[model samples]
Target chain A: MPQGQPLTVPNDGLTTKARRNAPLLAVHTGPGKGKSTAAFGMALRAWNQGFDIAVFQFVKSAKWKVGEESAFRELGKLHDEHGVGGPVQWHKMGSGWSWTRKQGSEVDHAETARDGWAEISRRIAEERHDFYVLDEFTYPLKWGWISVHEVVEVLGNRGGNQHVVITGRDAPQELIEAADLVTEMTKVKHPMDAGRKGQRGIEW
Target chain B: MPQGQPLTVPNDGLTTKARRNAPLLAVHTGPGKGKSTAAFGMALRAWNQGFDIAVFQFVKSAKWKVGEESAFRELGKLHDEHGVGGPVQWHKMGSGWSWTRKQGSEVDHAETARDGWAEISRRIAEERHDFYVLDEFTYPLKWGWISVHEVVEVLGNRGGNQHVVITGRDAPQELIEAADLVTEMTKVKHPMDAGRKGQRGIEW
Candidate 1:
């Protein structure tokens, strides 16, 4: 599609400006790379536009220091100190959210994921952030760690101008049906095909 | 692929560490969104790891104030002031590079694209930036504005550890063959499919 131009216009009663400004529920999924990275890129754009941003990583290990985490933390710090951008919150689901602690209990991936979804659902109901990134969230829905039906219902009825993006592989048909936009990152080729491993600042 | 792990190990004489650290030529193409966005996301990671970044926009108009452009400018300024991250240089081809000015001539997109490729080629030869983003570059190759053969040659033979990412749809087969990683952004669904137009922040 050409920049800023839609191929067709629906007669959905909404004006062009209203339809254009409607918040998006986007999903990035497939068996390729860059799904989370692309969502983070959109987060950067949202932050630049003064939109409050929140990211919840559902599947990645909390100990994994993905490069984007540090970069976003730095961006958050920049916003706090210099007021150059909007606020940011990053949370790793099973490790307990950064905002709340599950004190002495041993980590349970499924329970933690459920709790994380609960928190996110609460936030969506309250319109807590302008932009929400459910990073790798598809895994939870796919594995039955969370209810896809409930998640879709929440997202479809999310209030205000809140925009949400979910990223992972094998996104559920229900979620895809509900999303306003969806992109599948198909792997045409990979270094792994040539027996090459991932590297710092690139894969992470 | 799992983090930092390859499915197979090549018997190509190089050590695993050496192969892991080898620079990449990644292509993000196909008929969907977020190709350039994902590349910029990689740029963000690269910058966090102290990689100098140079982004060349080949198809976007110079007048387009992409949110990432302003955000990177702020990041570049932050680097200048506090030494927080790596430096960044954002360039829009046809309007002339930020480092150099072309005076007294009307813009010819094809010639300007060729000039942009020439500049990128020279930079690659000199090992200028640690990370290079040739945004929307495939169009020039597809349209015969710049040569795909020459691009593949320059990228394949580039010296040092410069990682280059090319983004746009309809990537040439030769270029894809030479790339270390290639992701095709397939459009599963889009807001435009329902007649919704692109919005600011998300589209730009």
Candidate 2:
């Protein structure tokens, strides 16, 4: 494919610019690394463009300190203090949804995931952010904690210039079908095959 | 696969921690998006861990602006002031290399690429950076502007805990064979297929 050019132009009636500026729903899946990392990378771009950025990391421990979290949090501060970039909000599953506070009960993984989806659903309806990253969200859908049909329905009707990217392994077929851009990160080889333990900087 | 666990551990006789801490040579290739994006994301993680970073853009025009470049430049500043992260150096092909000054001559694409490889090779030999990103380096190798055999040899013999990641399309088979981790970003769907032009912020 030519750099920055589409392989084939469909016979859709929309003009090129209109189609290019349309909102996109992207899903990054398959049994490989870089799904969430790539989503975060896109978030960096969106932030640079001054697009509102919100990242919801599902199925990861709240205690886990991801490098992206710190980087984005700093970027958020930079936006607030220096106005260098867009605002950023990073939320994880174990922690209560950032939009909705916890109900003061022990965390139930399934219920928490459902609440997370509900919050995201409400945000999509309101067009809360220009760019949204549902990081590692596929696990909840695959485990039936969140309804795939409902998720797809909301995403299909997002009706704005709001882009959403979901990242995780084994994405549901329905979700893939609804997505505008779907990438499968196929692992040809990995360090773990040599029994490498996950390192601090590279793995996280 | 289990999170952070290898499917099968080879009997390389190295301890688990040693294997885990071992430097990795990763390749992100194929006809899809996020090859460079994911590499930058990894660079962010490496930066947070205080790993020195050096990014070399091989094939892209220096006139082109990538969001990651600005973001990393800012992070590099944060490191200089508050010392929050690692030092960062970003270089493009058109400009003189960071390590080597430019000769007073017009830009030659193939020669510039070879110069970039030579600098990276010297850095690798000296273990200059903890993490290195050879962004879009595969294009030169694919075009025979640089020797793929030499690259494979240098990378295979790269000593110390220096991690290197090369991102681009059409990676040579020899480089893939030499890499410890290879991820092919296969495109299932793309916005361009709908006759969309590359949008700023997202595509850049």
TM-score of chain A of each: 0.94, 0.93
Expressed as tens digits, the lDDT of each residue in A1-204 for candidate 2 is: 235677777788878788778888899998877888888888888898888999998854653437888888888887888898899998887656666666425667788888888888898999999999998899999999899999999999896799999998999999999998899998888877766778878876
Q: RMSD, each candidate, Å? A: 1.7, 2.3
Chain A superposition TM-score, candidate 1:
0.94
Candidate 1 residue-wise lDDT at A194: 86
- Per-residue accuracy of model 1 over B30-142 as CA lDDT, tens digit each: 99878988998999988888889999988546545378888888888878888977899988874665556663156577878888899999999999999999998999899
Model 2, stretches more than 4 Å misplaced?
A: A7-11, A63-65, A98-107, B8-10, B63-65, B95-107
Q: Best-fitting candidate, measured by lDDT?
A: 1
Residue A69, candidate 2: C-alpha displacement in angstroms: 1.0
Worst 10 residues of 2 chain B by lDDT: B95-104
The global C-alpha lDDT for each of the candidates, from Candidate 1 onward, is 0.86, 0.85
Best by TM-score: 1
